[model samples]
Target: MAKQYTKNLIKREFLKLLEEENFNNITIAMLAERCEISRNTFYYHYEDIYMLVREILRDELEKVDEEFNETFSWEESLLHAVSFLLKNKKAAQNLFRSIDKKEIDSYLYKICESVMSRYVDNECQSKTIDAKEYDKRLVTDFYRAALVGLLDKWIQDGMKESPDKVIFRIGKLFDGNIERSLRISENLDEA
Candidate 1:
């Protein structure tokens, strides 16, 4: 429990620093001073700042995965995921603008792929679409690409619009198209 608390302290301090300066400008000594812990303590909890970021992103993505799976429909799942990101907009934006954009992208892709794959598998089980594994993966990749592109643009724009507006627009564009796309893929497989 004490270790958890210490790690959380380090993360909080790191995020505060992230918002103020570029990630590359921040260092272990700075984070340690902010946390009021020794540099050794910081290293004991995390190998480095990048590793800290990976853990932070992984934890948030896990929440996204869990919430998405718990929801009834893919649309709801997508909304849940987006809401999660918006709720953590500062952290999200900081990571987006951070030097570790690649790491953030990797985590976002993993979360999207996980959610889309589960959505496809559940839809197939419900007979919403009949698709082979390869087709399901292809459809998942398509949705993941669209989602990541949308999110990247949204973040880059500083999340100017409300979450509801973005969600509604995305739903209008994709709410029904996913199943249709999957079905098309299934037909192609059959042919």
Candidate 2:
């Protein structure tokens, strides 16, 4: 439990540092100093700064699991997730704009893919979506690509609009019937 407590402290301080500094310039030594712990102590919990980021991101992403259930509207679930992401806007921006854009992009894509996969599988059971097992995977990947592209653009655009707005407009790609219907046209959030 002591290690868990320390890990939480480390995650919080890491996010604070991310909000204040760019990823390129922030170092583990700086983070440890900010947390009032030795560099060795920081390393004991995290391999490096990016490891801390991954842990923090996992925690953030996990918060919306309850929102993923059958009770909430898909848009509401999406809004809740995006709103949580936007809560630490600066931290998210710094992380996204880092040198390892690929890893971060992949993480975001995975999250979207998971959400879309569940949605498709659940809906297709009742014939709402026309997809076989193999095709479902492909379509989910394609949709994930769209979401990732849009999110990347939002990051590049300095998040000019709130993530909820972005999600809403993206949902519109399915013509606002995304809740009950699944159709693939085009989502221009990347454009």
Which candidate achieves the best lDDT against the true structure? 1
Pairs with backbone N, CA or C atoms under 3 Å apart (clashes), candidate 1: none
Q: How many residue-pair clashes does candidate 2 contain?
A: 0
The TM-score that candidate 1 achieves is 0.83
What TM-score number comes out for model 2?
Answer: 0.80
lDDT of each: 0.76, 0.70
In candidate 2, what are the lDDT values of residues 1-191, reduced to their tens digit?
98898898888887788799998889888888888889999889888877887777777667655457644444555556666567888887887888487777766775676577766676665546554456556666777788778777887888778777757666666753442334442321221
Off by over 4 Å in 2: 64-67, 126-131, 176-191
TM-scores for all candidates?
A: 0.83, 0.80
Score residue 183 of candidate 2 by CA lDDT: 41
For model 1, the local distance difference test gives: 0.76
Q: Give the candidate number with the greatest TM-score.
A: 1
